[model samples]
Target: MYLLIASDLDGTLLLPGDTFGAFTKSVIHSLNRAGHHIVLATGRHQTDVESLLDSQSLPVHLITSNGARISSACGGLALSEELPASVVRTLIEETREDTDLTINLYCQSGWLMNREDRNLRDFSQNPGFQPTICATENLPLSTVQKVFFFQRNKDHQALTRLQARLEQRLGSQISTVFTFAWCLEVMTRDVSKGNALRQLADFLNVPIQACIAFGDGMNDADMLAGVGKGVLMGNAHTELFQALPDAEVIGPCTDEAVAHYLSKHLLQSTALPA
Candidate 1:
C-alpha cells in the first residue's frame, strides 16, 4: 500500500553541515518512484528548503517554518498562518537590541533579520535564504509566518531564558519550542508540523494511519507523535528524545540511518500501519 513518508530536514534527513548524502538522494528518489509520498517538513524558510531540493526535485509537498506555511507539489504555498501584528511589533521592540540573541523573521516577503548573522547562512545551496538585515522598525510584521531566535554557539542557556521570557509575555498567543537548543522558534499557537502533515494527508487523500514521520527535535515532537510510526534519530536532541521516549530510535543521521531504514522498507515492502 502507498504511504506518506514525511521527514524534518535538518537533524533528520541531512548529514552534518546541512548536506544530504548520495544514499539519501537515491532512497527518496526510489521512494517517490515507487509512489510513496514524500514531504519535506522543516523549521527552515521556503527558500532555504527549496534550495536544498532544487537539484533532486523529489518532494511532493513542502512544510516550512515549522508548519506556519505549507506548499503543494507545484511548490507554491497553499496554506499559511501569520503571527499577530501587534505581537510581532512588540517582539521586535523587546529583542532587537538584545545582542545575546539572533532574531529572524520568516515572512511572506522572505527570510529577514533584525541584525546581520553571517553564520546562520550555512545552507549548502545557491538561491538560498539570505538574511536581509532590516531595521527593527521596518520589519514586515503583518506578513510574518514564523519568528525565531538563535546563537552561533548553540547556546542553550540563553535560548532557554529567551523562551521563558517570550512565553511570559505572549503566553497563549504563540507556540514556542527549541527545534534545537540553539534556536528558539515562535509561531501562532495553531501552527505545528503535525497539523501541516495532517492537512497534507487529507489533501492527498492519504490517511493518518498510513503516515510515517521522522525527526530529531522538539519542534518535530508533534509531527512525530501524530504519525502512525514516529522514528527518532539516536542523535536527537535530549529534550526531544525525552519528550517522545516511546518513539522508535534509529542510528544517527551522520550515519545515513534514515536512508538505511527507508531502503529496507522500500525493498522489503514492510507494512507500517501499527
Candidate 2:
C-alpha cells in the first residue's frame, strides 16, 4: 500500500515561534526513507514556507495559502486557484467601509497591503516575507491567491460578524475560513486543504485510504475527515473536537507529539497485504 503523511505547520507540527525540532526532522527523514510521502499543508504562502525551511533539504509537498496553491516536493506547481477579480473588488470595497479591519492580499509573487497597519507590522516580523505597502486598487487582483483579514486584539465577535457578512454577500463565489480568533482567510470557493490533499494523492497514484493527516484547527476539519487516519493535537481548538469527535487525539505540538507518534506507530507498522 502507498501511504501519504500530511500535517499542518503551526499549532500542529511546530509549536508557537518554533520550527521543526531535531528529533522531528530525524523522524521525517526516516519516514521519507521508508517510502512515505510527507506534505506540509499550511495557511502560509509558498515563499514563506520555503523561507522557514531555509537550507533544510526535506523533500516535502506543499499545500500553501490555505490550499490556494499546491506544489510538488521538487517545487513544481500542481494547482493554482485564485479568487475572481470581481469578488476581490467587492471585498476591498466592503472591507474598506470597516475601520477595524486590516486586509492583506497574497499573490503568487508576494504579500501586498494597502496601509501599514499594526497587525501587519506584527505579522511582518516573522512572516518570512515582507508585505509591499501599496494601494488595494493597485494590487494584481487577477493573480491574487488568498486574502487575509486581521483584527486587533482577540476580537472574536468582530471576526464572526465579518465572516458572516462576507459569506452572505459572496455566497458561493468565495471561501472564508477563520484560521485564528482574530484572522479570517479568503480564497476561491474550491480551495481547501482537503481538496488539495485529494488532488495530490491522485497525482501521486496513492489511494485516499492510504493517507493520514495531523492538525489542530477548524480549517483542518475537512482534511482530518478526508484522510484514512486523522490525528488531532491535544491542544486543538474546541471546534475541531466538536467537528471530529472520532479523530485520534495526541499530545500537543509543543511536546513534539508528531515525532513520538510516528516512532511509536507508523514508522514501525508493516504495510497491509496487497
Candidate 3:
C-alpha cells in the first residue's frame, strides 16, 4: 500500500484557487481514508500554514520553513533545526549594507523582517499571519532556520553571479534554493524537504518506494529527484523538469491534472471511500 504523500504548497498542491478542486480533495481524502499520512512541506512558517489550513480545510502534518520546523496537525510539535548563532550573526552582518535587497529571517519563534520592508508590510496586513519586525542591525543572535534574500526583477545572470559568490564564500556549509524567481533562500546544509521526508518516513516506518512527492520550485527539486515517484507540475521551471528524468511530468494542478493522475493510477483499484 502507498504509505505517504508529501507535497509542497504555494505552486504545487495549492494553486491560485482559494480552494482545492473537488477531484483533488476527493483524492486526498481517499488517501487519508486508506491510512496514508499527508505532509505539507513548504517555505511557509507555522502561522502562515495554519491560516491556509483554516481557509482550505486540508489538515496536514507540516514541515515548514523548509524543514527548519516540523509539527503534527493535531497540535504536537515534533522537531526543528536552527542555524548556529554564530552563522546567523555572520549572515546578518554580511547583508546589512546592501539596501537593494530585503531580508527575511526564520527562527523557531517565527519570521522576522524590518518594519519598513514594503513586501513584509503588505504581507502582514493579511489576517491570521504572525511575523515580527526587528532591526536588521539589531536582530537577535539566536538560532535561525533560514535567511531569505528578496529582490525585485533579478535576471539569470544576476542570480547566477550571486549563487556563485555565495558558493565560493560558504561552500557546502549552506544550502540555497529559490522558492520564486525573485527570492533566494539559504539554510543549513542538512536541511531540506528531502532530509525532513527521510526523517518523517523513518518515523512512520514507510519505505521510500511507497511514497510520492509533488512540487514546482527549485526548493522542491531535491525531494522530487530523490523520491520513488515524483510529479512535476507542467508549469514548473523548464530547467527543473530537465534535471529529474524519472519524475512524472503532468499538467498544472489548477487543471485538476494531479488529482486525475492520482485517482486514475493510484486510487482506482484500492481506495476506500472518504
In order, what lDDT does every prediction score? 0.82, 0.84, 0.74
Tens-digit lDDT track of model 1 for 1-83: 43898988887798876778999998988887778888989988887877777876665689999999889885444999889
Better of 1 and 3 by TM-score: 1
lDDT, residue 211, candidate 2: 91
Worst 10 residues of 2 by lDDT: 119-128
The best candidate in terms of lDDT = 2
Pick by lDDT: 1 or 2, better one: 2
> Model 1 TM-score?
0.90
Instruction: Kindly report which residue stretches of model 2 are placed more than 4 angstroms away from their true locations once superposed.
Output: 75-77, 120-127, 271-274
TM-score of each: 0.90, 0.93, 0.87
lDDT of 3 by residue, 1-274 (tens): 5567888876677657334677777788887776778888888876678776775676568888888778875665488887778766666776677676677888766778754554554234335665677888767767688887766444455655666777677777788887767677888878898888888777777887677888888888877777777889888887687788657788886887777767776677664222
Question: Candidate 3 — which residues are off by over 4 angstroms?
Answer: 17-19, 55-59, 73-77, 115-126, 271-274
Model 2: residue 38 alpha-carbon error in angstroms: 0.4
Best by TM-score: 2
Comparing candidate 1 with candidate 2, which one achieves the higher TM-score? 2
Which consecutive 10 residues in model 1 have the weakest lDDT in total? Answer: 118-127
The candidate, 1 or 3, that scores higher on lDDT is 1
Assess the local accuracy of residue 240 in candidate 3 as a C-alpha lDDT between 0 and 100: 81
Clash pairs detected, candidate 1: none
